[model samples]
Target: MYIGRFAPSPTGPLHFGSLLAALASFLDARHHQGKWLLRIEDIDPPRSVPAAIHRIPETLSAFGLEWDGEISHQSNHHLRYETALHQLQENQCCYYCTCSRKMVAQRHAGVGYDRFCRTQQHTGGAVRFISSNAELIWHDAIQGKRTHAPASIEDFLLRRRDALWAYHLAVVVDDAAAGITHVVRGYDLIDETAKQILLQQALHYQTPSYAHIPIVTTTNGQKLSKQNLAKPLDLSCVSEQIAAALAFLGHPLPESLLRAAPQAQLRWATEHWSMERIPKRAAMAWPGV
Candidate 1:
């Protein structure tokens, strides 16, 4: 059985870019007759907005992207992350790093981590996974063959110095727990795949198929995101929004279906969804952005 997921952080309300990822994941799962799960990545409470958590699902619902089963939140899975961390520690696959971001940058001239604490017996700091120096490679559903050089990959954080679970660790643990078989997300996340694959290998979890769709960007080459203050998805124009998002994914609905209800548009899209139509690129400028 195919299982796909759309895990988004509740840092802000869903925007046009958010819809792109959600719609892609939803359509791919539906087209394959698989389950689509929603997971709120709220592990970092300081950055999460309480209201956004409630509004994300509401927005997805408004766009007719209903998920299977109850939604899961990262905040509800601390013990699982802790267990995974402990397993890595037991296997001596990770070490505590006392070096701060500034310290690493200053030492390595802005390169990746130098693994200075891997052998220094550091304590009471962030946990860093011992990344392998071998080349990491994988076949992406959309991006085709991808490879990360040994030098490009480095020891990544599993836990933050503030005692917060890192995104990579939490995401890998949650996806494995949910039995996710496929991951449809933005192209910007493609680089993180290697690190996540390493985590899966160390934890003995199955790696899921990945399809990174082109992200929506502005004319000036800025990805549409809350950080860039991308406008919140306009709920009043639900039909148009769905149509636009589907078009961005390379499955533009017919003129008659363009003005259809949100659910109607989604039904048409699902029935005719074609992954091959999606542009094979890292980013696409939004129309009239």
Candidate 2:
């Protein structure tokens, strides 16, 4: 069976950009007659808002984006992340780094880690995965063949000095463990795909197919995100929101369907969803935002 997931970090309530990802993932899964799973990416407790754990699902439900099986939370899967880290450690692909962000910035003026801690043996600090390969590349379903520059391909951290599992490590581990066959997400994460692929290779996990939808940005060209203070979607206008999301994906719905119920709108979208119609760009300006 084709298994797909919509993993949202509970840092804030769902916004327009997040709805685009959720709607795309949900429609893709339904179009393929596959199971759509929901996972709360609450690994970073400090950054997570307690209310979002409830609001996210409620918002998805309001938008008629129902998920299959029990919702998985990353916070409950510490053992799995630890096991994956240990596997990387056993493979000699992971190293302990004592360098802080400021330390690395001061040493390397360019992008990514400077590999200063690659030689130095540290006991307890951040754990970084060594990129043995010179080039990291992958084929995105939407953007086609993509390659990462050497500057972007560095020894990324698996675990932070703060003891939190890095997003790359946890995401790769969770996707592999949950048998996710397809990943439909926003394009802002396109750069991280290479790092995730590298981690999958090191951990000997099957790399799932990836389709990155264009991210919704503000008129100022800033990506819509919780950090950017993007407003949460108004559930009262669920149908309109769904229609707008579909329109943003290059599948504009008829005016009649814009006022329909959430389920009806999603039904029309799923039946007519076309991966080819999705824009290949990384970002698009959200109208009237």
Candidate 3:
């Protein structure tokens, strides 16, 4: 069974860009007769907006992107992340780092973490995953072959200094646990795919196939996100929103179907979904729908 997921961080209300990813994932899963699961990535409480959790599902429902089974919340899986971290520690793939952001920035000249703490023994600060694997190459279903040099791959954090589980670590653990076979998300995550694959290899987990659709960016080139203050999709205009999303994905719909109800629009999208039609670029200007 092909298990796909759309794990959204509950930082704000779902916007056009989020809907694009969600709709694409939902259509791909439905087209393949696979199960599409929803996971709330609320592990970082400080960045999470409590009410956004309730609003995300409501928005998904409004768009008729119903998910399979019950939703999984990352906030409830602290022990799971910890266990995974411990496993990495046991495998000697991780080390505790005491370097602060300021120290790392000054040392690396703002490129990324300089691995200054990789050799130094530290009591408690942050846990960084060492990318020792030589084969840092993977073929994305959309973007084609991707290769990353081990030297350029930073020793990313598994646990933040603030005690929050890092997104990279938690995402890998949850995806493996849920048996996710495909990852359909924005192209901005294409770079992170290699790191996630490295973590999966460290944990002896299967790397899921990846298809990164083009991200919707503003006219000014900023990716549409809560941080960018993108406007939320209006549920009252669900049909138009679905049509616009389909068009953005290069699946323009007929005028008749464009005015159909949410379920009808989703049904049409599911049947017509094609990976070849999706843009291969990393980001595209917002369609102004």
Q: Provide the TM-score for each candidate, comma-separated.
A: 0.98, 0.97, 0.97
Candidate 2 on 158-181: residue-level lDDT in tens? 999989999999999999999999
Look at candidate 2 and tell me the lDDT of residue 267: 87
lDDT of 2: 0.91
Model 3 residue 224 CA deviation (Å) reads 1.0
- Which candidate, 1 or 2, would have the higher lDDT against the true structure? 1
Each candidate structure's count of clashing pairs: 0, 0, 0
Residue-level lDDT tens digits of model 1 in 184-275? 99999999999999999999999999999999898888888898889899889999888899888999999999989988998888899887
TM-score winner: 1
Could you give the candidate ranking by lDDT, starting with the highest?
1, 2, 3
- The CA lDDT of each predicted structure is 0.92, 0.91, 0.90
**Model 2 poorest ten-residue lDDT run:** 129-138
Q: What TM-score quantifies how close candidate 2 is to the native fold?
A: 0.97
Q: Residue 248 of candidate 2: its Cα lDDT?
A: 96
